[model samples]
Target: MLSNPRTVEKTALDEFISQYKAYIPKPALVKSEPVGGTLSEQIKRSVTVLDFVGQFVELSPAGRGLCPFHDDHRQSFSVNAEKNYWHCFAGCGGGSIIDFWMKWQDVDFGQAVKELARTLLKDRR
Candidate 1:
């Protein structure tokens, strides 16, 4: 009596993103240190690649690992804890955790934001 995973709900996505944006405290316009940074950096600082991946797949620890995006047993997906980044040695491509979620889930940018917001909030409380 089980069902397939449901598609991303648009209404839910909109509501969640709206709520999340509302909840976040706005940063002041005053310039201090570095004014701009890479979008990837923002995402990496916000969430770890491992935790982000876990939200999609159940990964087991292996010495090295295979690229989940391709068919290979060799462990090539290297996650740098210090850099908070992941790269597929198999040439599968790489980006921030948010990019991974978007690609893996096949969702739009807004939907991804909503999904991330929900996940972060759930983890916090």
Candidate 2:
């Protein structure tokens, strides 16, 4: 019997993953590529953080822009299309599109999802 609960859980999870590793794609792609498996997924896949951010911020030729969340001037913000995420080098915080929406709108997670669905899915319906 393993005394450490975390170790026991890890072992079980590792065994399960090894058994079904082929069933999963991008094992650690949770942050950028959310597995919502629904409308949110559509929203995420239909566009990228760079394009979304570009709608409001003026990005440079290389997709770098000033941070809007703070008083930045040296283009501390950058959007990575390959990773499908945005980040602020000035330590303002960073994450996926949903996180950006939440921060931009000054709203909570639920509000962010609702607004994103409304805006992004407006054309689908």
Report the lDDT of model 2 for residue 15. Answer: 87
- lDDT by residue for model 2 over 1-125, one digit each (tens)? 35665667777877876989887777565545435556667778777888898898889978899999999989999988789888999998888788899899889988887889888878875
The lDDT of model 1 is 0.65
| Model 1 agreement with the true structure over 7-51: per-residue lDDT tens digits | 657687677689889789898797554333443334456678776
Off by over 4 Å in 2: 1-36
What TM-scores do the predictions have? 0.53, 0.67
**Which pairs of residues collide in model 2?**
none
